[model samples]
Target chain A: MAALVTVLDLSLGPLTGDNFVIYRSGLRWLVSDGHVCRAGEPIAFCNIGLRSSDGEIRSTAPFLREQTDFQLTLAAPMPGTLHQLPDASRGGWLDQLDRYQHWSESFIPGSLDITGGAGNQSRWRLIFSAGERMTELAEDRSGRLTGWRRIRRAWHGERSDHGTLASLGTCEQNGVFLGEQHDFSELLAASPGSLHVIHVGDENLVPAAAVLSDRMRRDAGANALLAADMTQAVLGGPVTPGPADWHYAGSALSALTRCPLSERYDLLSRQGLSPSVAVNAVVLSVNAEPKVILRHRKLGYRAYWHRFRVDTTGQAIRNWLNVSFEALSRTIDDIQTDLRELCKLLAERGVKHVLIMNALSTSGGESIFTYAPFSQALGDELPSVRMKELNLMLHDLAEETDIAIVDVDSIAAGLGAAAHLPDGVHQSGPMQDEVRGEILHILEQRDFFAPPRA
Target chain B: MLLELSLPLINPHMAHARVDSILVRPDKKIAIGQAILELTVDLSDQFPHDCPPVSYYRLCASEAAWLRHLAIAAGEKAAVGTLLATFSKTSDEAVENCASRALRTTVVGVTRQWQPW
Candidate 1:
């Protein structure tokens, strides 16, 4: 008898842009490492410098600046552990400016001492000694000091109450520096799993599914045999497949997993965000399990929500959906055919099992009132109704083929409209949990604890 | 008593790996948690890159014993749990006896240098 294969392929195809981390500019971190935060909680404060139209620094004080010039706080987009980037690793707008300034100077060793003062104010005294010259600075909080080289050039001239040459136009306000304006912090903890995640949706499903998959794999034995590629059904139209391009969905997945691409098409398609010719390449590649890659092909899918100018009114979107319903239906059929072929190929490759997740559309509900026209148009066709048709198709395919269906729509509907954001398609944490629960349930039923092949 | 030291399944996805370099030498005394060898696992096909997935494993020895046999050499591919070496608590007498016995056992017509007891 041949050795038993114990590899599981977990794929999360394209998701709507929900899983992508948005790195904003001009942030001063307030959260500590390993701090758990809820979604929408303020994690950091923005201390963006005010710049004039001519690109000159307007004010040095961030607190005294106008709201237009400085955003007060930066909030966590999702709930998870906050892994703050180290201060040395921080690089952003301010770092760029510092690099551009190219001020070269040799700095002597500095010593920091904390001194307690009146009114519960503790002062930090930083003393610097260069050659025979000694400089002392006092501040309530310690931050990067600037213009020191220029002040050092004029230090012999005079002394002021601020301890520096005030006549040289160097004051504490002008010298004070805000360290890092913007930096990145990962929210999720390191999930324990060997299963690879291949994301294929726009942005809606991937983030939640990735988090859930990590948890699920941990619950199942560390070395259980399982393989699955959860491909998201086409939401709107049939995209022509050719000319390798890179998609953010795929690039993001690849970057997250750190698994190198096996085939050139996977690399080209992911890098260019173009239609992929080798959709089945991952399944075909040997030892492909426990790897995560995205299978997105739609162009401009990431920014689709923000670019809704074509249908300012609900009427245009409604007319477009109504008119293109046939094309959309045909595209669904093509997708179904492609999936069927993929399942057949996977089965032929000696894959013991395969699981397919049904696609989900937004529930228009009352949430549409927030973005009236776009929301109204999305609700017009009852997107869930159309998605249900695809779901049923998957069910029929499951009965006829080796594929098993995980009904994400029923799960999403049970959560109601509020479970989703304004986009209607993207889900919040609760909805993500429901979807993950269903997948875990399916895997459990499939006998995750079965003995390895003899 | 004779003890066999075999490769461990460091990664579930890994089937077989090439011995990059042996950190321990034959007849050298080793301790628990001491790195014994470095294995270069192929992840090139999965992730096309110049760098391969390389990992080092430490010996989980139950007792102090002289390193006796080297069934695998550097650049040689070995399956998970393949007998790499053996140790004896008593003396080197068992090592000579085990090596002679291993010479007779054949896998696919190739004589194996170390046998798992």
Candidate 2:
């Protein structure tokens, strides 16, 4: 907007007097000749630019914006600092507002190593601690509100494996400022499957965020609907070395930064930026078993890397994996309690619907992850919340109250299991699409998001 | 009398611009004619080019009673399209807020006789 203002000024000359005020307020384009306010009715005062006094010509140009209920989510160079760009040639505020990417959620279940406490740290593999919260909510630092783009369908028709390394590396293709701690160059180097330069002690750039982005993109089957959206935060960068000193980020980085959507224009059509979407629900793990992501502890930067345990055991819990009967029952009981509390908290945040996504019942006896884990082995900790049984419980609950229940069981059962999940704890790549799809199906079939009629 | 207005810019079928209001007091009689006039004056300044100014003149009480007897001649003169509204009070707060911001009500409800355009 600032750049355009300058260009327009150079071309059109100084807007003398009230014309300046009109242009500055963005009302120069919308001034209407006259209007009527019948009696005492008050309406949202929009289109101030179209309003005109008497019957004189004010602005003779088309409006700067294609006025719709569209909300713009400005991503990057620090979304919070659009008004303060140090450089102007790359097109400052005007170019920034018309951003390339839309929304992103990066996750890093950083390495977990208990032996580090005892000093044998370098030898251990970094544990991929799961993210506990279902979703992390944030906005552009420059005080922009993020809104949902009422999408009728997912951008990709069929979920495809765009490659894990590729997705993680995409974020670094274009420079990004993670925060005050890490810059984009380091992040780029960390991605592309090599992070020898990044030590575990310097936990900023390399964390579970890279893994989460890969999982989400591959699992969700698309990079952010828009590229370079700040809504997402990265967990860990891939370990890819480069020539000389420049970073070598891979595919996921492209998926994160400005590759997928930038490469394809159709995906952006479904993307919309808004102030917010009413959601803060838990992504409970339906299965009691946990998936472990293997990560390397880039040693030498610090004494030892400590294990960070993300008990994604709670909010991020998903069903479909095989677990001890006790673990499954215990997890469900705990998750139910958490949901009860979430309902109270979410109500204050204006959430009306609470959806529970059903995990695929893939452990129908032959799954590898379920082989060692049958409830019969555990005497007392028997699992009660099995897949089919949980669906019935959810069905019964939905009938009893307004709490909406999304039956992911029937959908996933027909679609089969995802191949990427380790130990069958988390969802596999394409399976996530099937999962999100089935959930969306149930959501649409049922009145999960039916806005109240005014 | 309730005057139904249709604004074409809005959906024509849904053109009834509703001014939902809650009058706190109960059992108090409000002159409907005065209320309608107030509204017309309020919207007087809008749509100056397409929608012409309406009902610029008002009638005094003594003249109003006499005009009502002469059925052949007098009516509210504010030209809000074709329909001329009849009212008791010339102005209300709602009217003042919506009236032409530049036009000053120099004399309160002066009785002015004029031919309908």
Candidate 3:
């Protein structure tokens, strides 16, 4: 007696728009043929575009701003062995351009073979992702989320509305939020409900407390002043501005002008396009905090850039930074005050939950017996000492504010820092999974997915 | 008594570290908790992170000792077991061909602020 085999046909399900038709490129397979895929795991993706059905394009079409780099990834509806259809992909430029074919709802690009029996789901789940490129020339169609984008986002669910969570941290927080794929696959796979995640890169400007607060409170007049200052610095400065100098200056200005916390999103789902409120929760990294930051001398604005990143900038921009900004040293007390101000501003915007990932305090190499020889202000002189003190300050702040601290320090200590956290900032895969689990736990505890009150 | 300070395994992923700067000099008496040398551990090739995990650490003396001989200098790279320096219990003690043991020391993380203005 042979076992009963059930084959499920996966189709491009309903992705509706009011006055436009959906078009897509050839299939780009993520998994190989005959590979068993778990439910909710992305199996394939393709570039997508919208076309006006009546040849009358309106000012606002679906994903208008993100039309240049709009893409959709297909998630497995049920667990089974995947069998890709022969004509699904034509290879090369055919797979790159979205205008190659119309996205038919009845088209079956793949099938799944289940040994025993199949689950009820036969329709392929759609996960839409889009990236607003930092520069139009930064196009990378090689892989998923493969481009230099200033603002990249992805959303999934069947609900009419979605909850937004913006990740504004350094590489450490990016590893936890963006996952190993450099996409939101790990975070999205763990989340069964609806979520819209926005990730902003930290190459030009770090999202420290003082920096973010300054951005949030910056008015139009201040922005104009900043623009004038930057223009004058680049064009009138002593150093000659090259192409790289202009590029770096533009990116830095873009980072300084936009506030990720105040930006809303338009999410596409089964119910069509619906507006999501500004981020309900924000995840920050204490590692982004620096002992010293540069503040614009005349403008009275703060800019906290990593030393290595600043060193790599163009000579003109570096000269501009050197002449225009003054170094401001921040103590543990300064950091705490800046964080409290940020939380208060978030509260005014109706944002209640703020989760900060604490710094890894222990190095495992330190074997200090006494603190007699060290300076009285240990946090000011020692890096590990400063991190430990910063973590402590976060705890004190949490007592009064509506913020929760994610304990990366304790987790790293428990798992052995030498193996899991080699550089004290980045983590191994297992370590990231552990940190992700803690984040999910906190999100669940705070009922972050509950329906918004009217 | 002679003490030998070789590079310990400060980070598991590092094969070797580059000496960024030397804090103490030969024939100088270093007290406990005094910084000896600064080294950089870069795991950019060993690990798969978007940003290279390069860290700076300061090797400080845990036991008060007189610095006798310095083997490695600033800008030199050393392996895990490469001897960094030799120390003695007394400042005037001869350190020629003496049996030595591992020196008691602490590796503290440090930060370098770039001020190119």
Please write out the lDDT profile of model 3 over residues A1-454, one tens digit for every residue. Answer: 9877788888787776545677789989999999998988899888888779864435666566677678889988888889999888879988878887987888899999876656557678888788778888888999877888887888784555566777888988777878889878888777645778888879868999999999999987888899999899878888898888878888889889878776656666767767545688888888888878889999989998776666566788889988889988888999999999999988787776799999998766566676666765778667788898999999999999889999999899888888888778878888988898888788878888755545
B-chain TM-score for every candidate: 0.62, 0.16, 0.90
Give the distance in Å from residue A182's predicted Cα in candidate 2 to where it truly belongs: 21
Best by DockQ: 3
In order of appearance, the predictions have TM-scores of: 0.27, 0.26, 0.92
A137-209: candidate 2 lDDT, tens digit per residue:
2122121111211110111101111111111111111111121122122222222221111111111122222
Every model's DockQ, to 2 decimals?
Answer: 0.00, 0.00, 0.53
What are the lDDT figures for the candidates, one per model? 0.33, 0.23, 0.82
True-vs-predicted CA distance for residue A135, candidate 3, Å? 0.6
Q: Considering summed lDDT, which 10 consecutive residues are worst modelled in model 1 chain B?
A: B103-112
Question: For model 1, what is the error of residue A283's alpha carbon versus the real structure, in angstroms, after optimal superposition?
Answer: 12
- Per-residue error for A282 in candidate 1, Å, reads 9.0
List runs of model 1 lying over 4 Å from the truth. Answer: A1-192, A200-335, A346-354, A359-385, A418-424, A440-454, B1-117
Off by over 4 Å in 3: A54-59, A115-119, A451-454, B18-25, B44-50, B74-76
- DockQ of candidate 3? 0.53
